[model samples]
Target: MAALLAARAFLEIRYLAGDARRVSEDRSPEDDLERIRFLADVCHNMPGIAQPRPWRPSRRGAPGSSVQQAMAKRPMGWAWHTAGPEKRAWMLRHIENAGLQWTPPPPLPARRKGPSPMTLRQRAGVLLGRWPVRPPAGHLSLPPEAHVLKALDSDAICALYEEAGRLRLGLGKGGPWLRAHLDADSVHYLVPDPASYYWPGMPSTRGEIDWWQCTALLRMCDGEQVSGMVAVLPETFAALPSTLPRRKQVRLVHHARTTERDTYLWGRDHKAECDPQLCGFVPETTGDPPPDD
Candidate 1:
């Protein structure tokens, strides 16, 4: 039973470590180490981490330290009194293997520094949604060696909107998005930070910087979330000497009409009113009732 429990416990540790790695996120090495230590608690058969069940807990019982009791007698397993080198090495190895930067933690001054002061608090904040809440990927920095357009003689660009209440909802009323079509299937979307998705480069580009700031708008070019929108954002379509070399053939498009595919709803605008008088009664027999057969 001990051996079996030990195997299951290690399996969970590996599973947890793997999960941490698989997520498309960056975490500090200290964070991973803290996780490793808590897992050690599983091997030690400590409280809060009760007897193994499904990885997702849906059962209730007194927490058992059967796994710890089992590991204590196994080869190279933890003993109740030993917080030794073996345990420390085991933790460091897992962190390193997970491809995160691991600095050697400072030597303990004979006092076992269980989990750090911030560890459990950080975990709590994560569960409570107070931490690691990623804000919208707001205007990420452009890639190095960013693409700059000398001119665009054959690209059509404009704004797109879903109809019905698009004007009321003001989909493109802010910093106007500059959409471009490089091909029949390649569509690129661009918008200034404080511009309108509904309006073009008018008051949106009247600000200090337009072209450089709204250069790259990464997005799904294909119908599904697959292709990216990539094109240059030109402020004005003028041909003065200074702006001649910069002027390109850009299509200035206006919103046409809403399509059948625009699945817009006005439920909020047209809600059914409730009457207190009608609440207590079933509907009265309309007009007449048929004679009983």
Candidate 2:
């Protein structure tokens, strides 16, 4: 029984060795040529690296086989022999431009000192006698009666306002404009002229607001002239040590104080939003208006 077990173990070891040898032999000459070409290209691109010599097949080993014939015709040198199977496989994938030849990257241009050149649009505006209007600096001050429901971190606020009807405060020199639900479906906006409440430093095209940089300013009175609304931070409802309790009673106002003029002029030029729901489709209309406004 001991002899029989030893024989079985020997046979298993021989079988594994045979399998490994077969796998090695199965690699085609084309594969070796590809590897050799890739390595040659890499060596050529990198300075001071020695190029691999071509592979020459042994006449004693499978002399008439296609692989041997191919190797005889074009020998791929000894460079690939040192690379393990895993390394060879990785090299195959990362060979630049199919191992044709290595092209060195162009050198970067010299940097110019001082202010950058004006854009074509800016130049054109000047040529047309239109002076560029600069936006005001600082945060847009809220109305005297505006109430802060809660204070929270930026991430929490962005998540909370991720939904369709969230409001955004655009700070400008003229004053802050309360844009109604960010992605609501109202045909008409509360503020008709968008330029009047220009957001400072915002790109000409629509840009996103960082929730951390903004404070939620809600109007709490409903005296016909006053708009009653509430802005709450998401962190206020989260499970954190510094989180504040979520506010109640105050309604989420979806009324926009300004409409995008370009939307009307250009027939609704679609702007991509981080949240897909905020883009293209109008948000479902819900939430009651605050009483007394």
Off by over 4 Å in 1: 1-91, 94-154, 157-188, 194-210, 215-222, 226-234, 237-293
Candidate 2 structure quality by residue, lDDT tens digits, 148-186:
233333233334334312344322111101122232222
Off by over 4 Å in 2: 1-98, 119-121, 127-293
lDDT scores of the candidates, listed in order:
0.29, 0.29
lDDT at 289, model 1:
14
lDDT of 1 by residue, 1-293 (tens): 22333454577668657865758548765676677676566366532223443332111111113333343234223332344566555554555655666454332223111111334544454345331211123333323222122222213333222111142322221111112212234433332222223122324434433332222122212232111122223433122112111112111000000000111111111113212242221213221111110
Worst 10 residues of 2 by lDDT: 251-260
TM-scores vs. true structure, each candidate: 0.16, 0.16
How far out, in Å, is residue 276 in model 2? 52
Which residue pairs of candidate 2 clash?
Answer: 53-77, 54-76, 54-77, 55-76, 55-77, 180-255, 180-256, 191-257, 222-292
